[model samples]
Target: MIKALAAKAHTYVVLADGSVPNPTRNAPGALTGKVNTVLGILAWAGTAAGVAGVLITGAMMAISMRRGEGSEHMGRLGMVLGGCVLVATAGPVVTFVFG
Candidate 1:
């Protein structure tokens, strides 16, 4: 049974031209501009949000520091900075990998 199954699989795997098929890479049409515009808007919004997060976290940290609780907000600040890094790198990373 194993031998028969292997033979069947071999037959199916052998293509008529012995070449692998490749998909056509075509540019996105019609809605491409609209899609790009939306992506740009989202990117801008994300950057703005990151800036806001950092500013808010900084204010909180400052306030907490006055109360001698500064260390507690360090984690929140780190997270906000990390998010900013991610938002900044996401587009370039995606383009580098895909293109």
Candidate 2:
């Protein structure tokens, strides 16, 4: 049964027309300027948010250190640094994951 199913899967064409599958019939076309503008705005907003988060985290880390918190300060510093790394590599990470 497993072999028969595997054979069928290997031989199947999901679209009866045997043409390239286009799953985005209703999707926004890539040629539209509005899509690009919206995407750019969103990207900039995300970057700004990440910068704000880093600033806030740094302030918290400073306060923690001023209070003589060794471990907690280190943890906060690590978190802010990790966030920076993630934001910096998000595009590549997404591409790698999707591709």
Candidate 3:
């Protein structure tokens, strides 16, 4: 019984010390954590700004229509400009996620 108990304890000790190996740690040096944090924040910011641009464009169009005195052409132009910004922001987010 004592020998069995000792064997079990030894097994437990070995298993307890085993660690999960991180493959990233085995690779060549990569960018530091700070870079990742900054990139992540920038990605989130881009998405937020894109959504905000869309909202602003829509609001401008709505308000202008209600006023009934401004150029519809300018309102359309605002929408186009917002769409362009949204696309520009999307590119950064995609790269951040998959690259």
Candidate 4:
């Protein structure tokens, strides 16, 4: 009990003097920003891939439909495949944003 009281008193003394343990850190370090930039580039690339997939898929759908029944299924398959590619792109985007 005495030890506990002494510890509390010591903390109070420090507080009264306006001193804190582990002062606010000002340095983010050099590497932190560089790492962020690298991740940002990767994220942009992934987003670009998603956009390309969606556009290519849409184009394939249009061309297939114009070609008639023979290509209609192929066009639809392409669209579905493109959607998958786009959805997959989200993972990298999130990693970049949150990482």
Model number with the top TM-score: 1
CA shift at 49, candidate 1, in angstroms? 0.7
> For model 3, what is the C-alpha lDDT against the true structure?
0.70
TM-score of each: 0.69, 0.48, 0.45, 0.46
lDDT of 2 by residue, 1-99 (tens): 999998777657555548664444454576556866875686677778778877887788787678888656567657767776776687677669643
Please say which candidate is ahead in lDDT: 3 or 4.
4
Best by lDDT: 1
lDDT by candidate, in order shown: 0.85, 0.70, 0.70, 0.71
Model 4 lDDT, residue 16, Cα: 91
Instruction: List candidate 4 segments past 4 Å from native.
Output: 1-28, 70-99
Worst 10 residues of 4 by lDDT: 69-78
lDDT of 1 at 78: 87
The residue-by-residue lDDT of candidate 3 on 1-99, one tens digit each, is 999999999878877899643434433345546767777787677667667766776787788788985666566666667766766777567779655
For model 1, the local distance difference test gives 0.85
RMSD of 1: 5.6
For model 1, the superposed segments whose C-alpha errors exceed 4 Å read 1-23
lDDT string for model 1 (18-84, tens) is 8665657677786877877998999999999999999998898888888886376778888999999
Candidate 1 residue 87 C-alpha distance from true site, Å: 0.7
Residue pairs in steric clash, candidate 4? none
Measured with C-alpha atoms, the lDDT of residue 53 in candidate 1 is: 96
- Looking at candidate 1, the ten consecutive residues that score lowest on lDDT are 14-23
